[model samples]
Target: MAYSFPEEVLEHVFSFLRSDRDRNAVSLVCWSWYEIERWCRRRVFIGNCYAVSPEIVIRRFPKVRAVEMKGKPHFADFNLVPEGWGGYVQPWIRAMAASYPSLEEIRLKRMVVTDESLDLIARSFKHFKVLVLSSCEGFTTDGLASIAANCSNDSVARLRFSRTSNNVSTTKLLNLREIDLRESEVEDLSGHWLSHFPHNCTSLVSLNMSCLGSEVNFPALERLVGRCPNLRTLQLNRAVPLEKLPNLLHRAPQLVEFGTGAYSAEIRPDIYSNVAEAFSVCKQLRGLSGFWDVVPAYLPAMYSACAGITSLDLIYAAIQSPDLVKIISLCPHLQCLWVLDYIEDAGLEALAASCKDLQELRVFPSDPFEAEDNVALTEQGLVSVSEGCPKLQSVLYFCRQMSNAALITIARNRPEMVRFRLCIIEPQAPDYLTLEPLDTGFGAIVENCKELRRLSMSGLLTDRVFEYIGKHAKKLEMLSIAFAGDSDMGLHHVLSGCDSLRKLEIRDCPFGDKALLANAAKLETMRSLWMSSCLVSYGACKLLAQKMPRLNVEVIDERGHPNSRPENCPVEKLYIYRTVAGRRVDMPDFIWTMDKNAGSPEVL
Candidate 1:
């Protein structure tokens, strides 16, 4: 079919489609469509900062105004990635400073953003409106002060930070709508910063400072809430006592999301009732979290707001089965739930009975080293939930033992599941009943759940499960394997097929360099491949790097072996990704970039 539209018309038409996926698809049609799509792109998301050089991005998409970039692999969240491991923001900032003068917003995650980077951003962009940094480090209070002073326009509505700024006495954060200072280093800011918001400003919609350590003036908070009627999400730290919770909730009854301040306080019955009454008025509550050191006695106070809630996070609360049951009973509308393993099978049964709308559930281990008998739930709980919640879509179950029957039952019951992660606390656990390999059980999942996007496999397994995954799980994008697969053939099977696979994470597996090199072609299409504690060798890694010039093959030697020879040593960790940027200069001393053109690449 011949295209009818001219270049400008096609570009304008494609501009209506906001999704990057859609734009990417259209770009593949022809050279004309690709050029139009590139020119029309106003927003861009780079999963990895180094996937493409900033110069390449500027040359390709000159109109990009909003940029969201993620640095440091996802494992960095678990502290697996060492300190000073390189997700630096300087290189990208320098590139953007020259290319994207019109860039209005930037969102960064797990990146090291220094004061210099922030200052450059503040001074570079004339219309800079938003700057968000999550799980980022290396910037101090002075950096935030620079942002506050320079980006004072009403367009700058949101700000995120960790430390308290003492010099913001005249900081004009005009029309500020959201202030998120989550998990900050400062213990006390004297709550005086609350007065910084303009007197007439009522645009605030979200305020999260759940890590603040000092007591806040209740009256000031009350006045702030009263002024900002649009406030829908509020997270208070433990410094706010239970007695003050009632007043705060009453002030913001229209809140759709809330993070309750310390639930550990011992309060009088009247005070508890006040708290309950305050919750009762919150008719729009949908998400609730933050119950630090939860007291069972105060659990009932939350009943009124539970009915409308869809997401409840109580991973930090150690409430036993009975209290959990009471809460679950009220939360019939729940679609997502996170709880400690203390909620035993009985609690799960209660959930199945009440939360028929449940779509996601995560049961985290309270004590990973607890004895077998001390564990909370097992296959029974999983089977029970599977039978009850037919709409279940995702689960992260941490248990002591599981059965093949339970897994198969779950697969058959919830065939539409998008994510299924079952972690037996004990590694390489087998079917409790048959004492056999769990290959068949996992095979059932891949065969049954055709729409599965993510799967984390555990238990005793062989190459057969990988074969099933590669052949049957066509839609699987992410696969996490740990302490299971038999040989190189296991990794080979998955890599040879599973065409849609984007990320493969393997740890403590037997697969080595042969398996890594076998999927050389497959690795280019993938976003990333992370293998740790495998039998991969340095020689094979160098060979793989030599073969795939576009791929960044990195060996992360967490064990300080700086003096170790590359050819003789085992590549304990391997991180490989296809990038427009040949090799990042910010890589740490411990990270060896093994590409053949280690220090050279043609400019894009």
Candidate 2:
């Protein structure tokens, strides 16, 4: 006789479990646990929006309060995906509005969001608190104004009460809390949206409008910041000049993370003192970012707040190695750093010496298309950081040249690396020292790093590197490949292995139908597979779609008529994913949806 936990006891136990993976595992114990877990689940994450229909989601979890959904593939950021490649949030928002009225948070990435959808979201969820749209597009400032004006339902009730009684105060009517729009491409119609927020609304805790290209109304912004006492994170755009920063900082002295505007003001004594005094009072500041059009003279004004900063982002500053070294020496407690390769090896060495607690580092290429190794950054800079920062677990380094010996040493130094993305500027670049493929170097990375999860490969790679990855990268979840791999055998090695691989993106690789068809069943276990400029034929895509009714195999070809292409002709782009939603209806002319019942692919 097996004993079962009481329903209330099970619910209470499930409430303590936060990880989506753990909750999913718990729900699979039995039918009883499934029902119990379903009822208790409050937040749900949909990695791919098309993986499951919103109707299925509503049926599975009836009381969800927060939802996080991703739309397009990661390569969409590089303009590889077409305009109407179809990852719209309208359908999901409409369904959730009808079902989950109490939803408090909605986080979207790489998705299409129109002004109508924004207006709907602002008006639908009465208790909405957080809205994060990262790397999203197809929206304007008019849509933002809609959100600012009607985010909270209490505003209406407060308005009615204030009209009825002259003594009643409507200072704290709005309940909206956070609006994070990082790296989103929003059309700058106007910056007057800040004025739409209810006067004296004190609920905002985090507001990031740094991606906006237009200037915001300064008076409205100052008043809003002054009233929101709990605001902890504020990221301004480049339009907000450096001189106005001191005023905003004075208003929000409790900010924990701050992204400044253009740091290029006149080197006047009064301006410098005002900026220094404002930063001195921000005792709780821990993260600093944004310095667009930076003037080296104004850099010293921020030195007072550098001691406590654990995360520093100088990717946009374009400051030279000398100024970078001066700032890096001051941030002794720095843990995460994002900077351009303008820092050079000397600056990185200085960072390694000063910031011993660094955990993550990202070095972006200021001039990616330059054929020459002009920036003076190489594998040595990363090797230096690996030697100094013992706790380093992640790195994204973009360099022109690398050596097998340097990578092996770095891997040996940082065995705890979880995400390693090395993008050699030139495609299929070989090792500079020996002029050989980068197999041994990347092979050393997977073999040594036991916790490697996300990997982006570059440089000249062959089938041998894939063999190494298939054997050692047991926990790898996401892989990005471009202009590498020798043959279909390379793709076969990865598909046959990598049990936890959830997202696989490949472009300009030699893989084709054989590897994909042989590992057809593996696609159902993963989230998605995106391959473009490969050798995958239309016939192979159709067969895969027919064999697996649960999967959505889409062919995206913008060349010409979809029906004119032959069965043996290679597809321009193939997007395959496991989907319970059957088929998406928003696909444009270029996208051809492969149906199980149909003999050939059909354009919707």
Candidate 3:
């Protein structure tokens, strides 16, 4: 087929090409392609690895837009890439400074920077709009002063100095619309000094100064928000301590995204009420989080405040009443709702009724309920919810009871669902769960949800469940089954059917090494695997890993199990077998071996 569109469409298609080798293809194409070369401004990995440098390679394209220097140490010596790979990285950062005039964004990562580099960047990169010097330890606020001095007249809009000790003279920062000093260790600063933040940074959309050490004031943050009315997100987790949340929220009405950590009583009489009152002030908050775990009293108030929020991340927010119905009803435009609570079917039923437009749902049940937890919902609620919410792409549940019938109903109703969470709340009560295998329910998930890409199953699942998985779920790419009694059925079933699987995590699932060796060869496409338990066997570990050389396998022992009743005892004997080669070598069985870390990765 011959291309119909002009040079511009193809140029846009090649915009994501970050590799150096592909840039050569564009250059060799034709003189017509030279016009498109300038569009490939986001050059990646130059100098050390390749003979050609960006300055030389980008000769035909002078109007470069951005450059990302990948080599850098996040901590003192911890380079983001391998140690030997960094000598190839610094030359490119120098190249970014020397070249690229039209550059708007520059990310100089790790600790691979110097004062001179910062100066070169501040002075040379005139239109450096977004600069992220994350984990770059060689910086001081004076370097930032250089940027403020040079790019004061330029379009340096957003500056993020994350995990850096670079002391930024807050007063010198006057051009940026968004200033992220998140996790930046500045020794001395107060709310008063923060007043100097570039008031001209009017386009500031997100400001994350949460981890920055400073006695912040709502007045200063309000000023920051007032100057930039378009600001949508503000994270002052502990900046202002607990004293200034209300003033900040009330002043910044345009703020839609907000996150705060635990505050001091000086901010509000009681932490809960103060946080609740603070939340109530934000009328348009779309995405809000923190202060995890909520009490019933605060639920209504939170809903009242974030009335217009579309994405609510109340990971620890308390929701006890059917008031969840009123909350969703209040936020009629709500799209994504995450309740990190021991959510009951009744509450979910209410949520289903009120928040019909929900696209993604995450519910974590923190309560310890008996086996009755699984019977909360019948097959009908699943059908109703899956059918009712036409836009729902992902559903996650923890505390709620789930049966085979309900899963089938969900599959029958919403086959296009991308992600699903089925959990059985194991109780600590004296009576055993009598392990009723919901064959019907597990089968529905495997067969129906054709678009099922991610699945997380909680509680104990047995080996018999494998046949169910092998029969239905072939499209799964990521699977997480955490905290369960000894069971190998699910693992075997998954390996047999889920051929396209890429990421697999079996947390606290007792699938010993023998089972792994048996199923190892079937999982060739798997790229990442995490087994956190002592149930893995040595023979299976080598067999699987050796067979799939590409497997990024991590086998670790989670020694301290959830000291809860239903949780199993932390494996103690497995520690004796780990070897560099792995525990329990396939050659023979012995009481112990000199290889300390050997049987380790195997049965771990």
Best by TM-score: 2
- The reply for model 3, stretches above 4 Å from the true place, is 1-9, 15-153, 156-196, 208-215, 236-246, 249-251, 259-285, 288-307, 367-384, 427-435, 483-492, 510-524, 534-604
Off by over 4 Å in 1: 1-3, 6-12, 93-105, 115-132, 139-176, 179-201, 211-224, 372-375, 559-563, 566-568, 597-604
Q: What is the lDDT of candidate 2?
A: 0.91
TM-scores of all candidate predictions against the true structure: 0.88, 0.96, 0.61
Point to the candidate with the largest lDDT.
Answer: 2
RMSD of 1: 4.8
lDDT string, candidate 1, 412-520, tens digits: 9999999999888888888989999898999999999999999998888888899989889989999999898888999998998798998888888988878778789
**Residue runs of model 2 more than 4 Å from their true location after superposition:** 1-3, 151-174
Name the lDDT value of residue 579 in candidate 3. Answer: 14
Model 3 residue 192 lDDT?
54
Q: How many pairs of residues collide in each model? A: 0, 0, 29
- Residues 214-271 of candidate 3 have per-residue lDDT tens digits of 4555565577677666787887654454445666776677678887544334332365
Candidates sorted by lDDT, best first = 2, 1, 3
Model 3 lDDT-worst window of ten:
572-581
